[model samples]
Target: SFQIKINLTAPTLIFPGIEAHGPYSIVGKTDTSLIYLNNKDEKRVMYLVEIVKFCDATLEKVLNEVKLRIFQNKFWKKPPLLGELDLDIMKAYEREITKRLRHHKQIRRWESFVNGRPILPTMKHM
Candidate 1:
Protein backbone atom coordinates (compact mmCIF):
# COMPACT_ATOMS: atom_id res chain seq x y z
CA SER A 1 0.00 0.00 0.00
CA PHE A 2 1.16 3.54 -0.87
CA GLN A 3 0.22 6.58 1.23
CA ILE A 4 0.43 9.90 -0.57
CA LYS A 5 0.13 13.23 1.18
CA ILE A 6 -0.98 16.41 -0.65
CA ASN A 7 -0.41 19.92 0.62
CA LEU A 8 -3.66 21.72 -0.22
CA THR A 9 -2.58 25.21 0.62
CA ALA A 10 -4.24 28.38 -0.62
CA PRO A 11 -2.04 30.11 -3.15
CA THR A 12 0.55 32.34 -1.51
CA LEU A 13 2.56 35.23 -2.92
CA ILE A 14 5.73 34.49 -1.02
CA PHE A 15 8.04 31.65 -1.79
CA PRO A 16 11.24 30.61 -0.02
CA GLY A 17 13.40 33.19 -1.87
CA ILE A 18 10.97 35.13 -4.03
CA GLU A 19 7.91 37.22 -3.26
CA ALA A 20 5.48 37.69 -6.15
CA HIS A 21 1.82 37.15 -7.00
CA GLY A 22 0.12 36.00 -10.18
CA PRO A 23 -3.40 35.82 -11.66
CA TYR A 24 -3.23 32.29 -12.95
CA SER A 25 -6.23 30.05 -13.57
CA ILE A 26 -6.13 26.64 -12.00
CA VAL A 27 -7.04 24.06 -14.63
CA GLY A 28 -6.22 20.83 -12.86
CA LYS A 29 -4.52 19.38 -9.82
CA THR A 30 -2.20 16.51 -9.15
CA ASP A 31 -1.58 14.56 -5.97
CA THR A 32 1.33 16.82 -5.06
CA SER A 33 0.38 20.28 -6.45
CA LEU A 34 -2.04 22.31 -8.56
CA ILE A 35 -1.67 23.15 -12.25
CA TYR A 36 -2.09 26.60 -13.79
CA LEU A 37 -2.65 28.07 -17.19
CA ASN A 38 -1.24 31.42 -18.26
CA ASN A 39 -2.86 33.98 -20.51
CA LYS A 40 -1.47 32.29 -23.63
CA ASP A 41 -2.89 28.94 -22.55
CA GLU A 42 0.56 27.69 -21.64
CA LYS A 43 0.73 25.21 -18.81
CA ARG A 44 2.89 26.20 -15.86
CA VAL A 45 3.96 24.41 -12.72
CA MET A 46 2.14 25.73 -9.69
CA TYR A 47 5.01 27.50 -8.00
CA LEU A 48 5.57 31.04 -6.83
CA VAL A 49 8.22 31.94 -9.42
CA GLU A 50 6.34 30.44 -12.37
CA ILE A 51 3.06 32.02 -11.29
CA VAL A 52 4.65 35.46 -10.96
CA LYS A 53 6.22 35.33 -14.39
CA PHE A 54 3.01 34.02 -15.96
CA CYS A 55 0.98 36.79 -14.36
CA ASP A 56 3.39 39.47 -15.57
CA ALA A 57 3.26 38.19 -19.13
CA THR A 58 -0.54 37.88 -18.93
CA LEU A 59 -0.81 41.48 -17.74
CA GLU A 60 1.20 42.69 -20.71
CA LYS A 61 -1.04 40.77 -23.09
CA VAL A 62 -4.14 42.28 -21.46
CA LEU A 63 -2.68 45.77 -21.76
CA ASN A 64 -1.94 45.25 -25.42
CA GLU A 65 -5.50 44.03 -26.02
CA VAL A 66 -6.85 47.15 -24.32
CA LYS A 67 -4.69 49.36 -26.54
CA LEU A 68 -5.83 47.52 -29.66
CA ARG A 69 -9.50 47.91 -28.72
CA ILE A 70 -9.03 51.60 -28.02
CA PHE A 71 -7.29 52.12 -31.36
CA GLN A 72 -10.05 50.27 -33.20
CA ASN A 73 -12.84 52.25 -31.55
CA LYS A 74 -11.25 55.70 -31.69
CA PHE A 75 -12.28 57.85 -34.68
CA TRP A 76 -14.48 54.98 -35.90
CA LYS A 77 -17.92 55.96 -37.18
CA LYS A 78 -20.53 53.73 -38.74
CA PRO A 79 -21.22 54.19 -42.40
CA PRO A 80 -24.49 55.89 -43.40
CA LEU A 81 -25.56 52.82 -45.36
CA LEU A 82 -25.20 50.76 -42.22
CA GLY A 83 -28.07 52.76 -40.71
CA GLU A 84 -30.26 51.58 -43.57
CA LEU A 85 -29.30 47.98 -42.93
CA ASP A 86 -29.17 47.95 -39.14
CA LEU A 87 -30.58 51.06 -37.55
CA ASP A 88 -30.00 50.12 -33.92
CA ILE A 89 -26.37 49.09 -34.26
CA MET A 90 -25.55 52.03 -36.49
CA LYS A 91 -27.19 54.50 -34.12
CA ALA A 92 -25.32 53.04 -31.18
CA TYR A 93 -22.01 53.29 -32.98
CA GLU A 94 -22.74 56.85 -34.06
CA ARG A 95 -23.59 57.88 -30.52
CA GLU A 96 -20.48 56.26 -29.11
CA ILE A 97 -18.26 57.86 -31.73
CA THR A 98 -19.80 61.27 -31.13
CA LYS A 99 -19.31 60.96 -27.40
CA ARG A 100 -15.69 59.93 -27.81
CA LEU A 101 -15.00 62.83 -30.19
CA ARG A 102 -16.61 65.28 -27.80
CA HIS A 103 -14.51 63.94 -24.94
CA HIS A 104 -11.36 64.22 -27.03
CA LYS A 105 -12.19 67.80 -27.96
CA GLN A 106 -12.73 68.68 -24.31
CA ILE A 107 -9.41 67.17 -23.38
CA ARG A 108 -7.66 69.15 -26.12
CA ARG A 109 -9.28 72.34 -24.89
CA TRP A 110 -8.24 71.66 -21.32
CA GLU A 111 -4.67 70.88 -22.37
CA SER A 112 -4.38 74.06 -24.43
CA PHE A 113 -5.75 76.16 -21.59
CA VAL A 114 -3.40 74.59 -19.07
CA ASN A 115 -0.40 75.09 -21.36
CA GLY A 116 -1.40 78.66 -22.28
CA ARG A 117 -1.52 77.89 -26.01
CA PRO A 118 -4.13 77.65 -28.74
CA ILE A 119 -5.33 74.23 -29.76
CA LEU A 120 -4.03 74.98 -33.25
CA PRO A 121 -0.92 77.08 -33.36
CA THR A 122 -0.71 79.99 -35.78
CA MET A 123 0.85 79.27 -39.19
CA LYS A 124 3.36 82.06 -38.56
CA HIS A 125 4.69 80.23 -35.51
CA MET A 126 4.97 77.04 -37.56
Candidate 2:
Protein backbone atom coordinates (compact mmCIF):
# COMPACT_ATOMS: atom_id res chain seq x y z
CA SER A 1 0.00 0.00 0.00
CA PHE A 2 3.03 2.29 -0.28
CA GLN A 3 2.37 2.99 -3.96
CA ILE A 4 3.24 6.54 -5.02
CA LYS A 5 0.88 8.66 -7.08
CA ILE A 6 1.71 10.62 -10.21
CA ASN A 7 1.68 13.75 -8.07
CA LEU A 8 3.88 11.88 -5.56
CA THR A 9 1.40 11.87 -2.70
CA ALA A 10 1.44 8.65 -0.69
CA PRO A 11 -1.50 6.33 -1.07
CA THR A 12 -4.02 6.68 1.79
CA LEU A 13 -5.55 3.81 3.69
CA ILE A 14 -9.32 3.56 3.31
CA PHE A 15 -10.30 4.88 6.71
CA PRO A 16 -13.26 7.16 7.44
CA GLY A 17 -12.67 10.81 6.55
CA ILE A 18 -9.98 9.69 4.10
CA GLU A 19 -10.13 9.43 0.34
CA ALA A 20 -9.62 5.84 -0.78
CA HIS A 21 -5.93 5.12 -1.68
CA GLY A 22 -2.74 3.75 -0.15
CA PRO A 23 -1.28 6.46 2.12
CA TYR A 24 -1.36 6.44 5.93
CA SER A 25 0.86 6.05 9.01
CA ILE A 26 -1.49 3.79 10.98
CA VAL A 27 -2.62 6.49 13.42
CA GLY A 28 -5.88 7.85 14.78
CA LYS A 29 -7.44 11.19 15.78
CA THR A 30 -9.43 9.70 18.60
CA ASP A 31 -9.83 6.30 20.21
CA THR A 32 -13.55 6.13 19.64
CA SER A 33 -13.31 5.05 16.01
CA LEU A 34 -11.75 1.76 14.87
CA ILE A 35 -11.05 -0.25 11.71
CA TYR A 36 -10.74 -3.97 10.98
CA LEU A 37 -10.04 -6.45 8.23
CA ASN A 38 -12.68 -8.67 6.61
CA ASN A 39 -10.73 -11.92 6.72
CA LYS A 40 -9.05 -11.62 10.10
CA ASP A 41 -10.58 -10.72 13.52
CA GLU A 42 -8.65 -7.66 14.55
CA LYS A 43 -9.46 -3.97 15.18
CA ARG A 44 -7.64 -1.10 13.50
CA VAL A 45 -7.85 2.60 12.63
CA MET A 46 -6.08 5.31 10.57
CA TYR A 47 -6.46 8.84 11.90
CA LEU A 48 -6.22 12.08 9.94
CA VAL A 49 -2.91 13.63 9.02
CA GLU A 50 -2.05 17.21 7.98
CA ILE A 51 1.10 19.09 7.15
CA VAL A 52 2.15 21.97 9.38
CA LYS A 53 4.72 24.74 9.07
CA PHE A 54 6.67 26.75 11.67
CA CYS A 55 5.04 30.15 11.10
CA ASP A 56 2.28 32.22 12.73
CA ALA A 57 0.26 32.70 9.54
CA THR A 58 -0.13 28.95 9.05
CA LEU A 59 -0.49 28.24 12.77
CA GLU A 60 -3.63 30.37 12.97
CA LYS A 61 -5.24 28.35 10.20
CA VAL A 62 -4.57 24.89 11.66
CA LEU A 63 -7.54 24.72 14.02
CA ASN A 64 -9.92 26.04 11.39
CA GLU A 65 -8.77 23.43 8.89
CA VAL A 66 -9.20 20.66 11.46
CA LYS A 67 -12.80 21.68 12.01
CA LEU A 68 -13.45 22.01 8.31
CA ARG A 69 -11.98 18.58 7.56
CA ILE A 70 -14.06 16.90 10.25
CA PHE A 71 -17.25 18.44 8.89
CA GLN A 72 -16.32 17.38 5.39
CA ASN A 73 -15.15 13.87 6.45
CA LYS A 74 -11.66 14.57 5.22
CA PHE A 75 -9.30 13.29 7.98
CA TRP A 76 -8.99 12.06 11.54
CA LYS A 77 -6.40 11.60 14.32
CA LYS A 78 -5.55 9.56 17.40
CA PRO A 79 -4.08 10.84 20.65
CA PRO A 80 -0.35 10.35 21.68
CA LEU A 81 0.86 9.75 18.11
CA LEU A 82 0.45 13.44 17.20
CA GLY A 83 -0.28 15.52 20.27
CA GLU A 84 -0.33 18.87 18.50
CA LEU A 85 -3.56 17.94 16.74
CA ASP A 86 -6.62 19.31 18.53
CA LEU A 87 -9.60 16.98 18.79
CA ASP A 88 -11.87 19.42 20.64
CA ILE A 89 -13.40 20.28 17.26
CA MET A 90 -14.93 16.82 17.16
CA LYS A 91 -17.64 18.13 19.55
CA ALA A 92 -19.31 20.34 16.97
CA TYR A 93 -18.94 17.69 14.26
CA GLU A 94 -20.68 15.01 16.30
CA ARG A 95 -23.59 17.33 17.01
CA GLU A 96 -24.00 18.31 13.37
CA ILE A 97 -23.93 14.71 12.18
CA THR A 98 -26.65 13.67 14.66
CA LYS A 99 -28.71 16.50 13.18
CA ARG A 100 -28.17 15.81 9.47
CA LEU A 101 -27.54 12.07 8.99
CA ARG A 102 -29.98 9.28 9.72
CA HIS A 103 -29.03 6.32 11.95
CA HIS A 104 -25.47 7.60 12.27
CA LYS A 105 -25.98 8.04 16.03
CA GLN A 106 -22.45 8.91 17.30
CA ILE A 107 -19.99 8.49 14.44
CA ARG A 108 -17.99 5.32 15.25
CA ARG A 109 -18.09 5.24 19.04
CA TRP A 110 -17.46 1.63 20.27
CA GLU A 111 -19.41 -0.05 17.50
CA SER A 112 -17.78 -1.20 14.28
CA PHE A 113 -19.33 -0.13 10.94
CA VAL A 114 -19.82 -3.68 9.71
CA ASN A 115 -18.86 -3.92 6.03
CA GLY A 116 -19.21 -0.08 5.82
CA ARG A 117 -22.57 -0.22 4.00
CA PRO A 118 -24.71 -3.12 5.14
CA ILE A 119 -24.52 -1.96 8.76
CA LEU A 120 -27.25 0.43 7.73
CA PRO A 121 -30.57 -0.96 6.56
CA THR A 122 -30.69 -1.86 2.87
CA MET A 123 -31.75 1.11 0.77
CA LYS A 124 -33.35 -0.25 -2.32
CA HIS A 125 -33.71 3.17 -3.94
CA MET A 126 -29.99 4.03 -3.86
Candidate 3:
Protein backbone atom coordinates (compact mmCIF):
# COMPACT_ATOMS: atom_id res chain seq x y z
CA SER A 1 0.00 0.00 0.00
CA PHE A 2 0.98 3.63 -0.50
CA GLN A 3 -0.20 7.11 0.37
CA ILE A 4 -1.19 10.17 -1.64
CA LYS A 5 -1.50 13.83 -0.84
CA ILE A 6 -4.52 15.72 -1.99
CA ASN A 7 -4.07 18.73 -4.22
CA LEU A 8 -4.41 21.71 -1.92
CA THR A 9 -6.63 23.54 -4.38
CA ALA A 10 -9.02 20.68 -5.08
CA PRO A 11 -12.70 21.48 -5.12
CA THR A 12 -14.92 20.53 -2.19
CA LEU A 13 -17.71 19.12 -4.31
CA ILE A 14 -18.59 15.47 -3.77
CA PHE A 15 -18.79 13.55 -7.00
CA PRO A 16 -18.63 9.86 -7.86
CA GLY A 17 -15.51 8.22 -6.39
CA ILE A 18 -14.90 11.38 -4.41
CA GLU A 19 -15.24 11.36 -0.68
CA ALA A 20 -14.23 13.93 1.99
CA HIS A 21 -12.94 17.33 1.02
CA GLY A 22 -9.26 17.90 1.05
CA PRO A 23 -6.33 19.74 2.01
CA TYR A 24 -5.44 16.23 3.11
CA SER A 25 -1.67 15.79 3.32
CA ILE A 26 -1.42 12.03 3.70
CA VAL A 27 -4.33 10.11 2.27
CA GLY A 28 -4.11 6.35 2.51
CA LYS A 29 -4.06 4.26 -0.68
CA THR A 30 -6.94 2.01 0.30
CA ASP A 31 -10.39 2.64 -1.08
CA THR A 32 -11.84 2.48 2.41
CA SER A 33 -9.56 5.05 3.93
CA LEU A 34 -11.41 6.67 6.81
CA ILE A 35 -10.94 10.36 6.15
CA TYR A 36 -13.97 11.74 4.44
CA LEU A 37 -16.05 14.79 5.34
CA ASN A 38 -19.48 13.99 6.66
CA ASN A 39 -22.53 15.86 7.91
CA LYS A 40 -22.33 18.40 10.74
CA ASP A 41 -18.71 19.10 10.01
CA GLU A 42 -17.96 15.55 11.03
CA LYS A 43 -15.09 13.33 9.98
CA ARG A 44 -16.91 10.40 8.43
CA VAL A 45 -15.44 7.01 7.78
CA MET A 46 -16.29 6.20 4.20
CA TYR A 47 -17.18 2.68 3.21
CA LEU A 48 -15.02 0.95 0.61
CA VAL A 49 -17.78 1.37 -1.91
CA GLU A 50 -18.15 5.06 -1.07
CA ILE A 51 -14.72 5.97 -2.33
CA VAL A 52 -14.70 3.24 -4.96
CA LYS A 53 -18.09 3.00 -6.59
CA PHE A 54 -17.32 -0.08 -8.64
CA CYS A 55 -16.82 0.34 -12.41
CA ASP A 56 -18.73 3.59 -12.68
CA ALA A 57 -16.17 4.79 -10.14
CA THR A 58 -12.65 3.64 -9.48
CA LEU A 59 -9.25 4.70 -8.18
CA GLU A 60 -8.20 5.48 -11.75
CA LYS A 61 -11.24 7.69 -12.27
CA VAL A 62 -10.65 9.41 -8.97
CA LEU A 63 -7.06 10.10 -9.93
CA ASN A 64 -8.09 11.33 -13.35
CA GLU A 65 -10.58 13.68 -11.80
CA VAL A 66 -7.99 15.00 -9.43
CA LYS A 67 -5.55 15.26 -12.32
CA LEU A 68 -8.07 17.25 -14.31
CA ARG A 69 -8.68 19.61 -11.44
CA ILE A 70 -4.98 19.93 -10.78
CA PHE A 71 -3.91 20.70 -14.34
CA GLN A 72 -7.11 22.21 -15.67
CA ASN A 73 -6.61 22.96 -19.38
CA LYS A 74 -3.08 21.61 -19.38
CA PHE A 75 -4.05 18.08 -18.37
CA TRP A 76 -3.98 16.86 -21.94
CA LYS A 77 -0.59 18.41 -22.53
CA LYS A 78 1.18 16.78 -19.60
CA PRO A 79 4.01 14.68 -20.98
CA PRO A 80 3.90 10.93 -20.50
CA LEU A 81 6.30 9.69 -17.91
CA LEU A 82 8.78 7.06 -19.12
CA GLY A 83 10.23 5.88 -15.85
CA GLU A 84 9.48 5.15 -12.17
CA LEU A 85 8.43 8.74 -11.65
CA ASP A 86 4.82 7.92 -10.77
CA LEU A 87 5.84 5.62 -7.91
CA ASP A 88 6.76 8.72 -5.98
CA ILE A 89 3.37 9.85 -4.73
CA MET A 90 4.90 12.90 -3.02
CA LYS A 91 5.47 14.93 -6.17
CA ALA A 92 1.79 14.83 -7.02
CA TYR A 93 -1.31 12.67 -6.98
CA GLU A 94 -1.19 9.83 -9.47
CA ARG A 95 -3.23 10.30 -12.62
CA GLU A 96 -2.80 6.85 -14.07
CA ILE A 97 -2.51 3.34 -12.64
CA THR A 98 -0.45 2.28 -15.64
CA LYS A 99 2.70 3.17 -13.79
CA ARG A 100 1.92 0.74 -11.03
CA LEU A 101 1.17 -1.95 -13.61
CA ARG A 102 4.47 -1.10 -15.25
CA HIS A 103 6.18 -1.64 -11.94
CA HIS A 104 5.10 -5.29 -11.85
CA LYS A 105 5.90 -5.79 -15.51
CA GLN A 106 9.38 -4.33 -15.10
CA ILE A 107 10.11 -6.47 -12.06
CA ARG A 108 9.06 -9.60 -13.89
CA ARG A 109 11.05 -8.62 -16.93
CA TRP A 110 14.15 -8.00 -14.89
CA GLU A 111 13.69 -11.19 -12.95
CA SER A 112 13.48 -13.21 -16.13
CA PHE A 113 16.62 -11.55 -17.48
CA VAL A 114 18.47 -12.15 -14.23
CA ASN A 115 17.29 -15.75 -13.93
CA GLY A 116 18.26 -16.47 -17.51
CA ARG A 117 21.65 -14.78 -17.24
CA PRO A 118 24.57 -16.93 -18.34
CA ILE A 119 26.78 -17.74 -15.39
CA LEU A 120 29.92 -19.81 -14.86
CA PRO A 121 29.57 -22.80 -12.55
CA THR A 122 31.68 -21.08 -9.88
CA MET A 123 29.48 -17.98 -10.04
CA LYS A 124 26.21 -19.85 -9.50
CA HIS A 125 24.38 -19.23 -6.22
CA MET A 126 24.76 -21.94 -3.61
Candidate 4:
Protein backbone atom coordinates (compact mmCIF):
# COMPACT_ATOMS: atom_id res chain seq x y z
CA SER A 1 0.00 0.00 0.00
CA PHE A 2 1.22 3.50 -0.92
CA GLN A 3 0.24 6.76 0.80
CA ILE A 4 -0.14 9.99 -1.22
CA LYS A 5 -0.27 13.58 0.04
CA ILE A 6 -1.15 16.76 -1.88
CA ASN A 7 -0.71 20.40 -0.98
CA LEU A 8 -3.04 23.06 -2.31
CA THR A 9 -2.99 26.80 -1.76
CA ALA A 10 -4.92 29.66 -3.25
CA PRO A 11 -2.95 32.02 -5.42
CA THR A 12 -2.16 35.48 -4.09
CA LEU A 13 -4.03 38.24 -5.89
CA ILE A 14 -1.81 41.10 -7.03
CA PHE A 15 -3.23 44.61 -6.82
CA PRO A 16 -2.01 47.55 -8.96
CA GLY A 17 -2.10 49.94 -5.97
CA ILE A 18 -3.81 52.83 -7.82
CA GLU A 19 -6.93 53.91 -9.73
CA ALA A 20 -8.39 56.49 -12.18
CA HIS A 21 -11.69 58.23 -13.01
CA GLY A 22 -12.51 60.61 -15.88
CA PRO A 23 -10.03 63.50 -15.51
CA TYR A 24 -10.08 62.95 -11.77
CA SER A 25 -7.95 60.08 -10.55
CA ILE A 26 -8.05 58.96 -6.90
CA VAL A 27 -5.20 57.54 -4.90
CA GLY A 28 -5.46 55.83 -1.53
CA LYS A 29 -5.95 52.09 -1.51
CA THR A 30 -8.41 49.37 -0.59
CA ASP A 31 -8.33 45.66 0.10
CA THR A 32 -7.22 45.48 -3.53
CA SER A 33 -5.14 48.26 -5.09
CA LEU A 34 -3.78 49.64 -8.39
CA ILE A 35 -1.74 52.66 -9.53
CA TYR A 36 -2.78 55.17 -12.22
CA LEU A 37 -2.57 58.82 -13.27
CA ASN A 38 -5.36 61.14 -12.20
CA ASN A 39 -6.64 64.19 -14.10
CA LYS A 40 -3.87 66.44 -12.80
CA ASP A 41 -0.99 64.37 -14.14
CA GLU A 42 -0.26 63.10 -10.67
CA LYS A 43 0.54 59.47 -10.09
CA ARG A 44 -1.48 57.82 -7.32
CA VAL A 45 -2.74 54.52 -6.01
CA MET A 46 -6.28 53.33 -5.26
CA TYR A 47 -8.70 50.51 -5.77
CA LEU A 48 -9.00 49.92 -9.53
CA VAL A 49 -12.79 49.87 -9.71
CA GLU A 50 -13.13 53.10 -7.76
CA ILE A 51 -11.04 55.04 -10.24
CA VAL A 52 -12.86 53.52 -13.23
CA LYS A 53 -16.30 54.56 -12.03
CA PHE A 54 -15.11 57.94 -10.80
CA CYS A 55 -13.49 58.73 -14.08
CA ASP A 56 -16.58 57.54 -15.94
CA ALA A 57 -18.92 59.75 -13.93
CA THR A 58 -16.64 62.75 -14.28
CA LEU A 59 -16.48 62.23 -18.02
CA GLU A 60 -20.27 62.11 -18.26
CA LYS A 61 -20.56 65.41 -16.41
CA VAL A 62 -17.92 67.01 -18.60
CA LEU A 63 -19.54 65.88 -21.82
CA ASN A 64 -22.89 67.25 -20.75
CA GLU A 65 -21.32 70.63 -19.96
CA VAL A 66 -19.52 70.73 -23.28
CA LYS A 67 -22.72 69.93 -25.12
CA LEU A 68 -24.48 72.71 -23.31
CA ARG A 69 -21.73 75.16 -24.08
CA ILE A 70 -21.79 74.27 -27.72
CA PHE A 71 -25.51 74.93 -27.78
CA GLN A 72 -24.98 78.42 -26.38
CA ASN A 73 -25.30 81.14 -29.00
CA LYS A 74 -22.13 82.79 -27.77
CA PHE A 75 -20.17 79.73 -28.77
CA TRP A 76 -22.19 78.77 -31.84
CA LYS A 77 -24.71 81.00 -33.56
CA LYS A 78 -25.87 78.10 -35.73
CA PRO A 79 -26.54 74.60 -34.52
CA PRO A 80 -23.73 72.39 -35.71
CA LEU A 81 -23.70 68.77 -36.71
CA LEU A 82 -22.07 66.36 -34.30
CA GLY A 83 -19.72 65.38 -37.09
CA GLU A 84 -18.66 68.97 -37.62
CA LEU A 85 -17.70 69.24 -33.97
CA ASP A 86 -15.36 66.20 -34.14
CA LEU A 87 -17.02 64.59 -31.16
CA ASP A 88 -14.41 61.88 -31.22
CA ILE A 89 -11.70 64.35 -30.34
CA MET A 90 -13.99 66.10 -27.92
CA LYS A 91 -14.45 62.82 -26.11
CA ALA A 92 -10.72 62.60 -25.59
CA TYR A 93 -10.78 66.14 -24.23
CA GLU A 94 -13.57 65.24 -21.89
CA ARG A 95 -11.58 62.34 -20.53
CA GLU A 96 -8.52 64.51 -20.05
CA ILE A 97 -10.49 67.24 -18.37
CA THR A 98 -12.10 64.80 -16.03
CA LYS A 99 -8.72 63.41 -15.17
CA ARG A 100 -7.36 66.87 -14.47
CA LEU A 101 -10.29 67.84 -12.33
CA ARG A 102 -9.96 64.68 -10.27
CA HIS A 103 -6.31 65.40 -9.75
CA HIS A 104 -7.06 68.97 -8.75
CA LYS A 105 -9.48 67.65 -6.19
CA GLN A 106 -6.56 65.70 -4.65
CA ILE A 107 -8.20 62.35 -5.15
CA ARG A 108 -5.61 59.79 -4.23
CA ARG A 109 -5.42 56.09 -4.84
CA TRP A 110 -7.86 53.77 -3.03
CA GLU A 111 -10.40 56.49 -2.25
CA SER A 112 -14.11 55.73 -2.39
CA PHE A 113 -16.05 56.63 -5.52
CA VAL A 114 -18.11 59.79 -5.61
CA ASN A 115 -21.36 59.69 -3.54
CA GLY A 116 -19.59 57.41 -1.02
CA ARG A 117 -21.75 54.36 -1.54
CA PRO A 118 -20.29 51.26 0.01
CA ILE A 119 -18.78 48.82 -2.40
CA LEU A 120 -21.38 46.07 -2.40
CA PRO A 121 -22.21 46.51 1.24
CA THR A 122 -25.24 44.52 2.31
CA MET A 123 -28.33 46.40 3.45
CA LYS A 124 -27.91 47.43 7.07
CA HIS A 125 -30.61 47.72 9.68
CA MET A 126 -30.92 51.04 11.43
Best of the candidates, lDDT? 4
Candidate 2 on 33-68: residue-level lDDT in tens? 212221242232322222211123322333344345
Candidate 4 Cα errors over 4 Å, as ranges? 1-64, 69-80, 107-126
lDDT of each: 0.39, 0.33, 0.40, 0.42
TM-score-wise, the better of 2 and 3 is 3
lDDT of each residue in 1-126, candidate 4, tens digit only: 455775544322223432223322212233333233445655443333343434455445545655554355236657653443344434444555566666745553223354354333552323
Query: Model 3, which residues run further than 4 Å from truth?
Result: 1-57, 73-91, 95-98, 105-126
TM-score, candidate 3, is 0.25
| Residue range 6-109, candidate 3, lDDT tens digits | 54433223333434435322244543232333335544333333432222233454455445444543345655332233224422444234454456557766
* Candidate 1 deviant stretches above 4 angstroms: 1-85, 122-126
Model 4 accuracy (lDDT, Cα): 0.42
Show how many residue pairs clash in every candidate, following the order shown: 0, 14, 1, 33
Give the total clashing residue pairs for model 2.
Answer: 14
lDDT of 1: 0.39
With candidate 4 superimposed using the best TM-score fit, by how many Å does residue 24's alpha carbon deviate from the native? 22
Return the number of clashes found in candidate 4.
33
Instruction: Give per-residue lDDT, candidate 2, residue 51.
Output: 20
Give the per-residue Cα lDDT of candidate 1 at 32. 21
Better of 3 and 4 by lDDT: 4
* Residue 37 accuracy (lDDT) in model 1: 43
Ranking by lDDT: 4, 3, 1, 2
Cα lDDT for residue 63, model 3? 50
